[model samples]
Target: MLRSDAAGNALGAGRLKRMIRYTSLAVALVVAGCATKDDVDDLALDETPAEVMFNEALALRAAGDVEDAANKFSELDRVYPYSEFARKSLINIAYLNFKMGNHSEAIAAAERFTTLYPGNEDSAYALFIIGESYFRQIPDVGRDQAVTGKALQAMREVIQRYPDSEYTKQARQRVRATEDQLAGKEMEVGRYYLTRRNYLASINRFKVVVTNYQTTRHVEEALYRLTESYYALGVVNEAQTAAAVLGHNFPQSEWYQDAYSLLQKGGLEPQESKGSWLSRAFGNMKLL
Candidate 1:
């Protein structure tokens, strides 16, 4: 987006006329919205006080001119960098950009606010906006999860840095969602390897869900997959351990049933190994 107004600099006759027309429209809009004469003057002229500019931007937003409002806030920030209005304008820019679905711009603006005013009360909100921007851009489990990782990290930062802030609860929720997506991605890859009879590779992937993402919803399926992979590799002890873990943690889960049935097919049952990583991961839960 253009940083400076075209009319702010020297203009040719044609450009001047266009500016006049646009200015007239802006003035008409403010006037129609029951704005005072001063408000109309602020919209029609280049000489806006910081407070007036901030109010004008708010009026534009209220009038549903979101893009223009964001631009107006940007201009206010640029013109009054050290003023209190600048800080307010910067946060508004981030919020409006996010509302407009300009996620990247929202992230940039929010990051800028947080960096400039780390101690400000609005800094937590700015950080939340950055995390929300990344969360909104998260792709499906099939895609690279770099954005998901960033979202998770950003949300965690909000919780860690501003635990008492209003945004912390939602940030914590987003953290769980992002972690679930990452675990789902691993599960997808693990499933692919399993279908190709790549037992060891599949085991490695499912192990991630069990180890690093045990809190996620995918953990039950991850445990089942681990059982499947280890059984395919003729590692019966580990297979039993995995199935036992699944049954112990998710007794009613369909995945546990499947794991149990699979073991039964081989005249085996869900039994925990005396010493196994799966046992250690689940605090060595009792055998099923």
Candidate 2:
């Protein structure tokens, strides 16, 4: 019986040791679980896929999340340089900047594209878009014309360098429109001077239209104004000369008819003069 008791005690000791080991293992597993949770939290900060992150940022912009979208786009551009995705992302950057009213950044991206891909078929188009970026900022004819000049220069580059390109055709039309706008600005300034009876300055502006901007629709109005300004300044012969030029250059123009009537009141009428480009074949012409 004593031997049986000793064996029972040893077996109990072994079982107690096994139970202690099991309890220790359970505690260790709980501690590991807490550690794993901490690791998962860290992973949440860095687990974003590149494309997935990019798209998420774009989606935020489409949902009116501008600032966040810009951050993501910039990050993508930095990380994925020279990729097809990156090239596409840059264009989106331009569009996003323009949408956010950042004209300077939009123009920079457009110009950079043209420089980086000069042989690209879309280079001219990129340039044309840069011109449009400036064109959109032009205010009324009475305001500062800095943006108008910028648009004109950019469009001129597009036309002079890409004459055969379809972009040239479109750009030429814009050029004409912009020229007309600038001419209108000149007329506005001229009209202001005329309203104040500053005939000399008014005539100078009108002369610019005749000399530098003859192709504009404002030419007819300018010529008529010149005739009137000359008459107001008591320059009768100059008034007649201007009226004659107007009648010769624009026979079908209503301004010509008006100038003729004004000349009649001044004891004169616009008479035919040998001053036309065709009539200049006569001896008095400047041609050799």
Q: Which of the numbered candidates is closest to the native, going by highest TM-score? A: 1
* Model 1 misplaced stretches (Cα beyond 4 Å): 1-47
Question: lDDT of candidate 1?
Answer: 0.90
Q: Taking the tens digit of each residue's C-alpha lDDT, what string does model 2 give over 175-240?
A: 887888888988999999999999999988887777767788998898889888988898776676
Runs with alpha carbons beyond 4 Å of true place in candidate 2? 1-73, 80-89, 99-101, 271-288
Q: Write the per-residue lDDT of candidate 1 for residues 1-288, one digit (tens) a residue.
A: 553555556445545754675577666777688777676555543446789999999999999999999999988886566789989999999999999999999999999999899999999999999999999999999999999999999999999999999999999899999999999999999999999999999999999999999999999999999999999899999999999988888899999999999999999998989778988888949765
The TM-scores, one per candidate, come to 0.79, 0.65
Q: Relative to the true structure, how large is the alpha-carbon lDDT of every model?
A: 0.90, 0.75
- Residue pairs that clash (backbone atoms under 3 angstroms), model 2: none
Clash count of each predicted structure? 0, 0
